[model samples]
Target: MSDILHVATRKGLVSFKRAGNEWRANAPAFIGQPVSAVLADARDGTLYAALRLGHFGVKLHRSDDAGASWSEIAAPAFPTVETPDDNAPAVDMIWTLVAGGADEPGVLWAGTTPGGLFKSSDCGATWSLNDSLWNLPERKDWAGGGYDLPGIHSVLVDPRDAKSLTVGVSTGGVWPSADGGGSWRLTGTGLRAEYMPPDLVFDLKMQDVHRLSACAAAPDIVWCQHHNGMFRSIDGGETYSEITGVKPSVFGFAVAAHPSDPNTAWFVPAIKDELRIPVDAELVVTQTSDGGKTFASQSDGLPAVSYDLVYRHGLAVDRTGSRLAMGSTTGNLWTSDDSGRRWTQIHGHLPPIAEVAFG
Candidate 1:
């Protein structure tokens, strides 16, 4: 089980430390500022926090000694392309941040709004835009989901191969790169997009993947919580197979995969895309231990009549695959000690959670 849990909220970034069985919150950091994303790198015990200040712009901070101290670092910035008529796209938010593989220390990968990927080889001292993915001609057809421009929120680095990466884009589809970010190919074969036209329903680039999680022990098994429904990929996201007929509704933004068990995964379901709330005002978590063949609704400690919603980054499972943490848009936080069988509400009155992670 993890001893530390970090939550990025609409107001600030909160950290919690587990003492024996009870988790205690530390003095909140960056209060009164909206933390867009938080990353606790297990590689070197480094913590990275991204703050989205309305008028001050986006800022990135790093804490080498846990949360005791922090220093401002260079946030990912888009290259200046001074075309006479075209304005270079600015990075509005760092949607997702992940450290490189175990062997590659001081390396980081960041996915940003306006649909761009960045790489840092010097521990975020500087960043360079991936021109291969950014200059792709197909990007012209990409559209946004929640934001005005398409954003890459999920970046999965193959545990076995640091160069192999898969990213899930909203309003865009699944993109896999075998030689790191040097080249890219759009996948997501069996995914369906009901929001698109009949002819474009199966278009790989038209599908909206809410989030993507792959089992660390079984890297080939990838789970996708898509805008249309839930999907699973057995071959490392090269292709996908939609899992349908789920209880409640299949519309949700978050999905957390067991770290060791490929067949075991968790999903927080909502009514649908039109109604982003619990099914019939009940917030329940659906778990599948046998791939997606069967699902069990685990809500022993959840609210019976609630209106909380979990975002794509709101659900997370620790390295043990036994400890899980979930946060909601309604300021509710819960943790499960035995997978998803039951949950214990930690905080019900925190700021609206944007992301949660266990370190």
Candidate 2:
């Protein structure tokens, strides 16, 4: 069987297949404006994508034929609107979508751009606002300017329990729902919140997490790539310990856990500053064979010198744990078939990419 890769691009959704050593790009999956998120449900082989139009609110698209074609679904309305701005009503853009409920194959959970959690009961055909999270008092404090509260960048559903879920807000920190979004609590104990002053205890911004991946073998085990460095949580994010140590430039955007090994994972470390110079940039994918105790640079096949910036939402690893792919804002997609130790530019002719996913 061929491995299919889904890429969310500025132009539209693109699908590619790995045939031998070459990646052949297929026709655009969604037409019109750019796509914000593209995901493939492993439980039912259904494809879900979110489109971001200029002022026309976000739209959800789904493809049952594995990106061969797509159809638009009626977008769900955001529950709370303070005042109707002169502009168009801001629709919550879905950032991440995951298949939920083993008994109900079509049930899907989605995280939104405004950092709200949602659910789709009819297999991505329609969705409803999850008030359990959207109506929280803390939801009003989410910031949305820059690397801040852009949306729910990461959403993790427990593999063992369908009722448990965790989501990461760009600046708001991590929130956990034990009863499937009915009640939520801030799980940012060890995370660094930037709002807190430097001298304060447990500043929120110390670990502005962008991506979260739970170990398949150990559900309580999770890894995070924060704005500062990398972190690992053995107790399902209750607390975390910095694993990157004193690396001069330890800023990264994405993290991927090994499919079968909870202690092994990979991450793409970018240049620390905005200068975009590679002299100080690591430009390497770091790996930890024994969890996050120690990480070694895995740059055998990656660029030796480049200023490509890997965004916070762009790195992903396949279920087989053999392939790793990361999309760059510089409009290039890098793939590694040998567990991130080696990589190659599979596709780079498209517009700047926002996110990438493999199933």
Candidate 3:
């Protein structure tokens, strides 16, 4: 299990270190600033934080000596467009960040708002946008779910091959690349979108995938929390099968797949998109140990009767697959050591958490 936990919140980036049986909070970095994403790269012990400075624009920072110190790095930007009709969209926020494979040192991938993917070879020194995905003609059909424009929230790099990648866009659907994003194709079949017209219900391009997570040991076993319901993929997102009839509700924004167990995954359930709150005003994390065939509602230490909602990146499981951390928009946080059987509240108030990561 990891002894450190990093939380990106609406106010700032906060870190916690495990102290015996308790987690102690460290002096928060970027305090009072909205931290949209945080990545604790285990490859080189480097820490990265993405800040959304509203009117000031997006900014990124790197910390080599953990959270003790940090320096601003180059944030991803769109290339200048000469034609007025070909107006390139600016990056509104850095939604997610992931380090390259062990063989590729100093390489990083970033998913940003307005549906753009960027790559860096010299850490965060410079970035180049993936023009292949940006120039997709079908990109015009992609619409926004929560933000003004669609965003790529989940970027899954297959453990077996660094060149193989899968990205989850809010309203753009699932995209898989075979040649390090040199080429791309949409292939999320079996995903049903009730929000769309009946004729386009099965259209992959219209499915709103809130989050996508894959088991580390078995990268092909992927889990998805969709706007319509929960889905599972055994072939690395080429296709998915909706797992319906989950208790409470299958509508949620966050999903976490166990690092080792392909059949085991966790989801934070809510009422629905129209009513984004805990079922019966009670928060719970549902667990599926049998590949979504069955579910167990686990809510030992979470709020009994309250309104707390977890975002797309709010839930995270450590590398050990034994420790899990969950943060909420209401500023509540919890940790579970025995999978999802039981949980312990680590902190009651921090800030509106955007992402939780372990290192």
Tens digits of per-residue lDDT, candidate 2, 1-359, equal 22888888888887788888788788886655788887788888888888888778788878888776778886656644567665433455766777786666888877776666778889877778787777777766676623334577777888888888888877667787888878888875665543456674364433356788888768788888877567888898878777757243456777888878888988777664466433354467778888777777777766666666777668887877878888877778988888877788887667778788875
lDDT per residue as tens, model 1, 1-359: 89899999999899999998788999888998999899998999999999999999989999999988889999999887767335668888899998888889999999989899999998888999999988888888788887888999999999999999998899789999999899999998999998788999999999889999999999999999998999999999988888999998788999999999999999999987677789999999999999999999989889989999999999999999888999999999999999978899999999999999997
Error of 3 at 253 (Å): 0.6
Give the per-residue lDDT of model 3 (tens digit) for 1-359. 89999999999999999999999999999999999999999899999999999789999999999989999999999997787464557999999998988888998999999999999999999999999999999888888976888999999988899999998999889999999999999999999998789999998889899999999999999999999999999999999999999989999999999999999999999998678899999999999999999999998988779799999999999988889999999999899999977899888888999999997
Given candidate 2, what's the lDDT at residue 346? 86
Span of ten consecutive residues with least summed lDDT in model 1: 79-88
Better of 1 and 2 by TM-score: 1
TM-score of each: 0.98, 0.91, 0.98
Assess the local accuracy of residue 180 in candidate 2 as a C-alpha lDDT between 0 and 100: 80
Positional deviation of residue 130's Cα in model 2 after best superposition, in angstroms: 1.7
Candidate scoring better on lDDT of 1 and 2 = 1
Where does candidate 3 stray beyond 4 Å?
Answer: 83-87
Model 1 RMSD in angstroms: 1.1
Per-candidate count of clashing residue pairs (backbone under 3 Å): 0, 10, 0
User: 41, model 1: CA deviation in Å?
Assistant: 0.6
